[model samples]
Target: MRSVYVFPGQGSQHKGMGAGLFEKFPELVAQADDVLGYSVEELCLRDPDRVLSQTRYTQPALYVVNSLTYLDRTTERGELPAAVAGHSLGEYCALFAAGAFDFATGLRLVAKRGELMSRAPKGAMAAVVNLDEERVREILTGLPFRNVDIANINARTQCILSGEYDELHDPRLRAAYTEAGARFVPLNVSAAFHSRCMTDVQQEFALHLAGFDLAELTLPVVANYTARPYPTKGYADHLAHQISGSVRWYESMSWLIAQGHRDFQEIGPGNVLTKLTAQILKDPLPVETAPAPQPAPAAVRARPRTELVFMYGGQGTQYHQMGRGLYDTDPVFRDAMDRCDAAHRATAGTSLLAAVHDDTRRGRPFDDILTSHAALYSIGYSLTEMLRAAGIHPDAVLGHSLGEYVAATAAGALSFEDGLRLVTRQARLLQERCPDGGMLSVLDSPDLYRSRRDLFGDIALAAVNYDRNFVVSGAGTRLAALQQALDAEGVITVRLPVRHAFHSALLDPIRPDFLALTRDVTVTTPRLPVHSSMLAGRLGTRHGWDEYLWDVIRRPVRFDELMASEFTAPGRHFFVDLSASGSFANFLKHGYAPALRGAPAINQFGNNSGTVRALRDELRRLAGV
Candidate 1:
């Protein structure tokens, strides 16, 4: 079951919207205050200055409050979505979720964005209720209102029109919309957003965006400009364009529901997105008032028992002290790690355990391509063994990116020694042949190719994790430049920590070598059903396993299409993450229905033994064990 967190833009702000959250996340509030040079908590809770209604204050306050609400929710559950999206100002929060930038960076950007926007020429916007976009567009283009634009397509029938005050309030145009079965109500916005009137602001904002550092997206964030995900390469450009581009709220909401996100939580002041989402999906998301902030103990929910779908995590999910406690406390897990280390010692030339858990060489293991992949695979494989030894087994298995080797091995398609050799061999060959390059997880989708045809030098889409979640790979310098451009515009991106770019042209030099090495590796049909990220479907025997292994190196990971197909089938499935971090769990939540969501990672809180016990208890409750 996938869940979506939708944030509202300017129009949704209220006098006392963030009352419950300000006290809950005082640190974040303080950070926001520091960035804005004022007390955001006071503005949100008291609004004594009525500044919350102004565009400059509204944008930053909503952004901070929305971010805190999101942090609070995750603090309660420790899970993020498969993808994230927001309305105009709220997009910054979505970008934050995607790991494009840190919280303080987002606050500063949003504050600046608001300040710039508030300086725009004054205009008026009105909500034209019960009118479709096509009709509204025709009205705007054909008459004295030609200068007017459909600023926001909020729902199937609700369109927000923006232009000069006199034109928007013209008696004839308002009469025309009303006669056409629409209720036109004037809006209190200080200036036109997502309209041509903001052209200068867009350009100025782009200039401001050029200074910020945008990491690639960690989660998929649906961008308002394209009614899809923001691309990894052009973060600031899109946000800049968004100043004069219509907010495709209705289309964005429709696309998510069509992609299988059924549950939604509005993480801001009002239920604007929630209400609009209901209109788009033609079904209401259950609504409730904000609960007073309180201490939330670790929670475990039973019932709705389902078959397990174990997902071995890919790269970018590794961290220091990842499996440290398991190594010390669980003999089964430790033995598997030891065996993997000994087996791959010749090729790796280092201790796998030390690479992952050693405190001394903290950053080296993450930076070295061979070490990182080896650590990810060994930890995942060992965890799988430990889970099985504890009488926990999955009905189906899947892997993201390089995690496929572990999935295949666990499913009996390859032996442990062979899988390790295959992973190590591929890593070594790439390190030998490929120059240092980078992979950036962006928030845009494949539609980015057609919608925004701007060229990103040497960058290719590496993975389409979900509708909005995508990765681009290219040379290190070019990738860095792309990230900077995006960061300036407030588009979020995450630079995947790796020595060389995988699944990009950078890896082409080693393809032949990789294929040749894997040619002699043994292949067998899986003992359990296995899904392929490269194929975007179930692994089939029609092609030799050798071909699949090589294809994994060449093709983009189609995790979005693969998981979509899995959930379209009828039974409940728990997508449990067997990686170092539970980051993939958040991705799964945004892609599948809420019922399919599960833990991000065991021991995410660093209380390894307690977390393991809780996981076992939850599994037993789920399986009726």
Candidate 2:
């Protein structure tokens, strides 16, 4: 179970949002006033002049209140969520939590963003409900409404449109909406947002973003334009494009849900996002209303008989100083690290642990494809041992891509030494032979890309992670060209963090070498159930161990199908991600059936001691210990 903190955007503001928070964080409030050249406390607490309704005043006021609200909550709770997201104006709040910049810097930028938007020509914006994106686009594309563009995708069936004020006021357009059985309500905003109407404003905002320096976010912040978590770099470019891009609220929420975040807390004033989230996720009970005859509060459901499944993550998942806390706090983990270090030194003549445990705490050039694989194998295998020592046993095991080695070792199908040997050989061959390429997580169905293969020259569909999410791998230039084309068509894509384009034709040359490395190691029958992601089925007596090892390099990973099979089985299941960062839990949660929505899926070492404590508390509650 993971928690996501969401912040509301501009339309959620009210006359008295920061009433209590203003006095609680006076220093922050003062700083906000000094930065914006106005009294944020007065605008939020009283709004005596009624000027807070204006876009310029509204953005700064809401930013201050939202920031104060977050500070107040975290101060009292003494913990941070696993990730953060924000609506249009609220994205600044999310970035603040990521530590991309300071409070003053965020306030300064928000003020400018608001000021520029306020200066745009007056335009009309309206919400269209009970209609999907395709239908809305069809309506706006035909006849005199061609200039209208979608401003916000609030939910699967809800969207907002922005266009010239005069064109939107036509009675015929309103009649067309009524005839289509869609409810249309005009918004009070004076300027059109997230549309071509703000092109000039967007250009100016880009200049503002350039002047400020933004550090990489500590926690992932889902972007409104991309509907994916922000990448390791390029914060400035994303924010610049976001000025005139549609606010992908529903998609962003769904992405978070797919990552296994079941608990979401609305951080700012007003329950707009809270109510909207309930609508998007389809919570049966209305979140905004309380009826007089409301039923009793839902009881905490008792845990059913549960089974645990261990999933290992593969390459490109490692980062600087990963497992730092495990090496310090857990002696078992440290001992395993020492053993891996010795093995690595024996083979490579240098200790890989020093690079994995880089004291600089910053990314360097040496954190490349070769070292990343070594660290992943060492840290992942050691963490599994620690879990076994703690009496946490797995009923089954599987791995994604490079994680198969750890999975095989944990399932007793192979020895740790042999697994390390295979990993080392694979890494060396890949580093020495494979050409440079990239992988992009295309946020659409495989059919979407497969149907238009001609458009994606040289790019191959590597893996289908979910119904609408797939990965495309190919040479760097071709992949970049594909990404640009997708962006132009309003399709979201994320560049995966990996050195080589894997699960594609580029790895074919290294297959024979990898097979030779595997032949030297002895194979045995599994002591526990071991699932094969490549086969998208259980590794029954049908396939030989050597065959799966060869297929690991030659075949693509069918993670989507593998999850569907696991989640649909007879008993309650828990997917535990044994990776350095524990980020794979989100993908497991994403593929889970709706019936298993609240199951206890755990991610080891996400926050070191915090994750350990959460796993303990959940297991005890389930066992009734």
Candidate 3:
């Protein structure tokens, strides 16, 4: 069987993805660092700066890791594959591996491409699932809307639509796609990519492409623009055109499968293209006319003993505009958030509305205790409402430190109004009374921390996430020194974007005032089970919201212990990460459970709110509801 190496694009990148690949090829990593004018390894291994999610840095880092993986795999096999292909940004790696361009030249082009693309005008992209590209095009052509374009033909049933953000989110257009038997989901991207909106960047990138010397491919590497092997000449034009041209990923894979290449090897971080290949191969084109669009006939019961778990995260997960995708696209989410904003105003807290939805404040750091704390509660509560509105009611909910506040509200331990008031008031107390401090994420066992106490002696254990993952809390001023010390010992460390050292003695100053505020609060038994990270187990007692909320703030987060106690059959649980960045979901991914797929939540990456629709569809499909 012939084999083809495929690389994934953006949306595949994740923190801690390139753990050892950089060390395997130190020389290449060093060269990459030099060309990129930054430590690519540092960016990959521990992006303390949190800039990896940005398009400009994401591309270069992905290219290096993908290149390293390709090089490593081929070296072990002592041979190259028959052909190579990549999706979107991954195509650069395909070309580089095929000897079309040398390392530095390819890196330069990718870096420039990322920077240009990052600057593309604000627009949107949506994945239209369950519809063929032809049908999507036919629908778009018939719609009264204009400027929309297909960005990626991912599979026969999954194509990405891009254009002006407003036009893409238009209800008439979405209804057309849905009426035609498809799921229209607006992605989390901030710009119109691979559409005419990228024309400006494409022209600039063409100039950048002309500056580099290119070479003919030694191995067949299919192009994203034409979906075939590159011609001997004008490689620059083909590379540049894909900027504004739709990626022919499905067709490219089909051509390979047509040649009997069934053994496909995914060379990069994610299984995105791999999954697309399986889908494309599963439903090879000329699809029998899809039966007319059908509504789910009847609501069905969930599997016996099955559950929906709402998992929440604390700080370091908040970002400006985290839930803007849903706020713009989903009315239920928007309405909940509007109520949250009204609460924010009534409570005299910071403008929660402007902090998250205003485009002007998009890139600014939202790590302050005032903004992050309230934002976390707002997004978490509103997201839960959105999920529950879609019939995905949580059977159990878990919270990590500040997450417990929102979780309590979600679990009915406290009312929404009370939860919002308490969250905002607590933020005020922490910001005003608690001295500045920070937290550190160490990707090693707690045993490491115990063994290296001399170095981490000043820091307090904040949370034990999983087996090898733990966090430490310390003074804000000492955070830098602690990170440097860990670096000297070759320990992986990430300074979580938090200003207050939560769950530590540093917050002792605010305890008196904090408890005073919650003392008069009323509570009720949760309708569903509520797990507490501080308690390290299921919440107990029928009341005492004051003590519970205060203990959540002042105690260490024993996340793993709580999870371990609950660990059972994956089929019995659905762990949904409701944090802005999917922190809880990322923490649980360490377990590699099949149920993780069912807990669809937003992330810092592509199509943030798209996952919400994915969750609804999965629940509807599985439960027939």
Candidate 4:
């Protein structure tokens, strides 16, 4: 049973925060007093000169009390936590607890840190509640917001913004957030402490930081910048960047959850960190006005043994510049994408990276099946790797159409290089031999497609995503006519970006060539359970995988059939949608399955890294982590 000791930062400071701890650790308090050049106990308990709330005094005082509290608790318990973490100013105390530095040295450092941060330029910080990072980013991106950056991502819907005071308080800005169903509350701070506004302060602090040598950590200390364990070297760089960079508290906790840390103890004055920890570990729910719900029977409904299924979506879910953010922000995602790109370029003399990032700066609707097919495989495989790196392993895999190749690779039925080759060859065949057509998404029952012959007589049913959502493929003229007729009937319809009518007669000409290309490929039972789009249930001990693979694209997708069978099963199951646009999760959200829940691996909005962290936390809670 591993655990983490979390320490709160500046905002937790208050009068009498160190009441009993100061007396318990007299020697340490004395050392802190001398190092800080003031009575540590007095500033925390009395604040006689009213400087305790000031940044300089507040930091040192909080550090002393937090360290003392930690020491006292560990001595009484006869042990230390398996790991330690802290928020902003609390990081120094965390490092001290991990044996990275001595008490006096830590006190001296926080004192200097406090002094530098206190001298920062006038700025503002605001806590925006009830809006996710993606939605908040969407709101801010539309406006000309200068110097404003997100300083802290505390939870799924809570974040702190640090920037120029005027920009944060602009009447139109606050009004915009308010209109979009968010509450923005300004924090009492004078400087944009963890933003570019603190660059000058960070540089000066780095000069001071160069004077001391940090010791090797005795235990893991998750970093705020990387949201993972700190490396042995680069203490100065990590610390310097932290001063002027956003605090990824939410991501840090998500990483901890991935590491099998289920218990978190907040060793500080207030319960802010405790509240945040609880929020991060719990499943997010909407506010309801129905009757009160009964308590869960944890013993009867065990989640620790829950099954995890990774579901991958196919085309039309992708947009231009897909995965661009994760590529730039997450090293793990970048490495995985780079590997896939290398394989892609080696085989086809092309780069999925170019498909994802075009010369128009950002791309538009990318419908080139040659590139989109390969891109889908690359993204699906890369996301699986990213999730695995965060300790999320799929008990089974589900792939739709082109995504089946990725699933096959994940399940050990196909080699990564072989999978890439097959995908590119299939894309090429479809481009050369198939008729010009497209896919249309209809928001209606599958039965409607059968009854309305005039509308869908010539089109082929491609996929059934859920009870009321399905896709049809055919020539462009027929798709347009169907979309227009559906729109007139108040039926929601969307034209998918595709070049050919997949799963229809339009693609029959390419089957011979596609089969010939894959004739020499080996197919076997997957190491992990696979529920494919063409199958009614899990692929169990089946042979002729090559034919099955071909049928996966040529046959209509029966995702709803699989969902219908599995969602009603008795086992504890969690679906993790590894789609670029989160389409599968959307289906689960609306389907009338009892207590069915799912988490998406990526988002179309510019927050894939953070979104995946949120997904980890969300799904971890379901697995009883």
* Model 4 TM-score, 2 decimals: 0.51
lDDT of 2 at 305: 50
| Candidate 2 lDDT by residue in tens digits, 211-293 | 98888779889888657677645457567667776787877787677665678899998898888888777632111121111
lDDT of 3 by residue, 439-485 (tens): 99998887777567677766778888877889988897687888998
1 against 3, candidate with superior lDDT: 3
Best model per lDDT: 4
Better of 2 and 4 by lDDT: 4
How many backbone clashes does every candidate have?
A: 27, 1, 2, 0
lDDT of 3 at 199: 66
lDDT for residue 491 in candidate 1, whole number 0-100: 68
lDDT of 1 by residue, 1-625 (tens): 7588888788788888777887787787788888889998888878898778888888888888888888888889878787889898889899988888899999888888888888988888999988777577545533434236788878767889988777788899898888888899998776877775776776677778879878777777877765666655435555666677677777777667767777988888878777778777884222112211111111223434576878887777777778888889999989999999997896667778777777886554376767777888888899889889999987778888888888998988798988887888788888788898878887765565334436564576677777667887778898898889877867688888765777766777886788788877887657776878775555643235666776675667768656643343234577778877776776766755463567644544576766677778888887776
Lowest lDDT sum, 10 consecutive residues, model 2, at 288-297
Better of 1 and 2 by lDDT: 1
Candidate 3: lDDT of 327?
87
Instruction: Show model 2 residue runs off by greater than 4 Å.
Output: 1-304, 361-367, 597-606
Total clashing pairs in model 2: 1
Model 1 C-alpha lDDT versus the unseen true structure: 0.75
lDDT of 2 at 296: 16
> Model 4, residue 375: what's the lDDT?
86
TM-score for each model: 0.51, 0.50, 0.51, 0.51
lDDT of 4: 0.79
Candidate 3 worst ten-residue window by lDDT:
289-298
